[model samples]
Each structure stands twice: as structure tokens, then as C-alpha cells.
Target: FGTDTANQVEEALKSFKQANVQTLVLDLRDNGGGYLTAATDILDLFFSSDEVIYQMKEKNSAAKKYYASTDSKYEFVNGYILVNGNTASASELTAGALQSEKGYQLVGTTTYGKGSAQTQKTLSDGSVLKYTYAKWMIPNGTCINGKGLTPDIEVENVSLDGISTKDVKETLKVDCVNTRIKSMQKMLNILGYSADREDGYFSVATQDALKKFEADNDLTVDGEYSQNDKQMMIARMMIYINNHENDKQYEYLMKIIK
Candidate 1:
């Protein structure tokens, strides 16, 4: 979902060496684990004497923890990582290593709680199970198998206004979100929303169309559309569409698209 690993890590360290950095936050919300060897090499940058960072055990096989010979080069003034229930596998491994082992503080919510390790193997049935065959444990010997590590600090936008979709004038990332406006227009046309175009460009007519869509869905009458506002509105339409077309072969696929 981002730049290549080598580039991202190098850029991070370069940014780190820039100034007196306090409270660095590494976000791994939608990150999926890649090459184990790559993960091992990256972990070496954060540890002393290239010791074992993590042990990946799978199936009835012998388990092994990776070790690096190189010493740690950069230490954080304040290291913080963000993980959500979406975080999985090697992401959890890195977080657990830095936290329970290397002592990097964790923020945000708990992890996905998927502790069992899986290696790719073709099954006898010619299908892939990606089965979990072994458990991964942190250096502190805490096995986060099935139960994720809870965040030290839980930040909730507890304001009722936070949940309220009404009165939002605009989104923060407006330029990057105009493509969504096009999608809204397409969906609006499918549902009889009036608009002159579906070109994926934001225009006054598109904003008005969104306002009408919001009003139809009982969303706040705000003229400017936020990502959530659009998403919630789409989700409602999709649910209605699904309910009516539940018998369609593509109905489940529609849900997946959503």
C-alpha cells in the first residue's frame, strides 16, 4: 500500500537523523508482512548485536529466530508505534519486538491477535489454506496468540460531534479525495441522483448532488462532503441494494466491493 520497504526505511532513518525528533509514531494500520528475510534485516537496525529478533514457527517444523550481527545505529528519543486490530503477522512481530523486547512504547488500539504463524504451502486439494501451524512469542515470552496486545493508551474521539456526520464543511485531504466525488456521482446516477456529469472531478453540481444524497440518507445537510460522509451514505445505499438483490450471484461480490 506504500513505497518499497528499502526506500521507506531509508527515508524514515533519513528523517530521523534530520532533527531532534521526539515521539516518533510508526503507523502499521494496513501493512501486511512481506519477505521474512527482509523483515529480519530490518529488525537488525533496531537491536543490539543482531540477536534473535523473532522466532517464526510453522507446522511440525523446527522453529528458528533470526539474528543480526550488526549493531543498532539509530535510537529514538521517543519511539511510539500505532497498531490497530488490522495489524497482523510481521507487523505485530516488529511491534512486539520493539515493545516487550526492545522497549518501544505502543499507542492506539490492540493488534489483530493472530499469533499462529503461517507459511505458504499448496494443499493436497489444490487449494491454499494458509493455515496457522505454530505460535510466535515475543522476547518477553508473551505469546499474543489469538489475543492481541492492548494499547497502553486508548484514544477515543468520544465527542458526540465526532460521531455526528452533519455540519462537516469539508475534508482535510480535499485534493486527494476528488476521485471519490466521481464515484459518488456514478452511484448517484445509479440511484437517480441528479448531476450533469460523472467525470470524477469535483464541481459545484457534484457537491450539490452529494448534499441531496446526504439528505436522502438523513445525513447532516452540510454541503461539503467528507470521506466518512460519502462512505456512510454509500454503505446505506449498498445495504439497501443488497437487501433487494440478495439472490443475485454478484450480491456477495458487491459487498466485497464495498
Candidate 2:
């Protein structure tokens, strides 16, 4: 949290510099946050010395300003900070600092706004007392306490549209043979409805599975995977994969559909 963490970050930056990486993307979609100093220290890497990165103001204590140090080691041409609803506290600090100070672009959805600073105090008992000590602000004096910072490029949590199977006919019944039938089977299995296999043949097992899926999802249970059923499955699979966005299997399913 103190020295070792800073050392690791420095080492990673060294590697990036050695590789001559110009564009850096820091993906902090699910990063919750940690030591406040660590956030500011990393923020220091992008800007020159004496630049105001962030501000800390408490009720009782005087306002404190955090400035960038002489640690502009990597002169990256551009920086992108990826964030979402799970990005909070230190993650927000880092994003806000870079955006406000260096004009770095933020991608993805809005962040989880938690701009309060906390301090740890040791009591007589051996236990520590942690309390909110200050509130942080961006360099422009913008407070991101309850309202999260919006991304410059707002990409919805779902994948882009038109990522489904192509050239679907109006009807697909049992024993129907189509090349995309295998893709349908793959998506069905991914959504937990067993298509049994992906042999590009619409067998009876696939039909039964489709019927059960349609019934469960409140679609027309006609035992036929028609155009309406394909549309319904597309919507259903989008929602399912959105919910399971972090799972690699669902991610692969998304890629295959595209």
C-alpha cells in the first residue's frame, strides 16, 4: 500500500516506456479504489511538475492541493481511462485528475461517484478509527461526490447492435438445414438451453430446447425457431450477456454472434 505499491507501478511504467507505447489505455471498469496517495502518485506520471491535479478540503482542516511531481517519465501521445459503474474513490480520482489536468479521454459508462477522502486514526485500544476526512475535487473545482463523471465516448454496457446471425429466413423448423443453425445452437447452449450439438442441423432435440426456451421467456411456444423467435433470442441473449458481461464464456458468445 505504501512503498511496494509505488514500486510496482513504477516498474510497470518502465516496461511501458521501454516498449515505446504511445497510447495507454487504463481499464478501470470494475476497479473499486484503494489508498488515496497511490491514486495521486499515478496521476503524477502524466503531467509536468507543479500542475494542480486535485484538491482536498475538509470541514475542520485547511484545504490542501495535490500537485504533479517531476515524474512525467512516459510522454504518451494519448491516454484513455476506461470506467463504469463500479469505478469509485481512488479510481475516480485518477480519472478526474487525468481528464482535468491532461485532457485524457474517458471511455465507457459513467463512474461510481465517491469523491470523499478518508483518514485512519489510531486509538488507545490497538484498533484503528477510519473516518471521512475530506472531499476531493478536480482541478477545475468540480465535485464528483454523488454524480459520476460521464465518459467522453459513452459506450453502453451492451455490445453494438447488428451482432447476430446473418441472412436469417422467415421460418426455421425441425429438420431444417442451414449454415447458421450451428450458430443458433451455440447461442442456445450459451444461454443455458442445451442444443446438444452444433452440427448445422435442426434436430428434434434442438426444437424441443427452442420450445422450452420460448415458453420460459414468454415467447410463442410453437416449437419453431422462426424470424420472430430469432429476434426474441437476440434480445434475450443481449440481456443475458449484458448481465454476465464479466464472464469469458459469455464474452466469447458475444464475439461469435458478431
**Which ranges of candidate 1 are over 4 A from the true structure?**
1-3, 58-64, 122-129, 157-258
The clash numbers for all candidates, in the given order, read: 1, 0
At residue 25, candidate 1 shows an lDDT of 62
- Candidate 2 Cα errors over 4 Å, as ranges: 1-3, 60-62, 125-127, 158-258
Please give the lDDT score for candidate 2. Answer: 0.77
Q: What range of 10 consecutive residues in model 2 has the weakest lDDT sum?
A: 248-257
Tell me which residue pairs clash in candidate 1.
50-68
**TM-scores for candidates 1 onward, in order:** 0.55, 0.61
What's model 1's lDDT at 258? 47
Cα lDDT tens digits for candidate 1, 4-121 = 6745685788687797665556766546655545555666777777466777666687666656658755677666666667777678777887887666766656787766765678
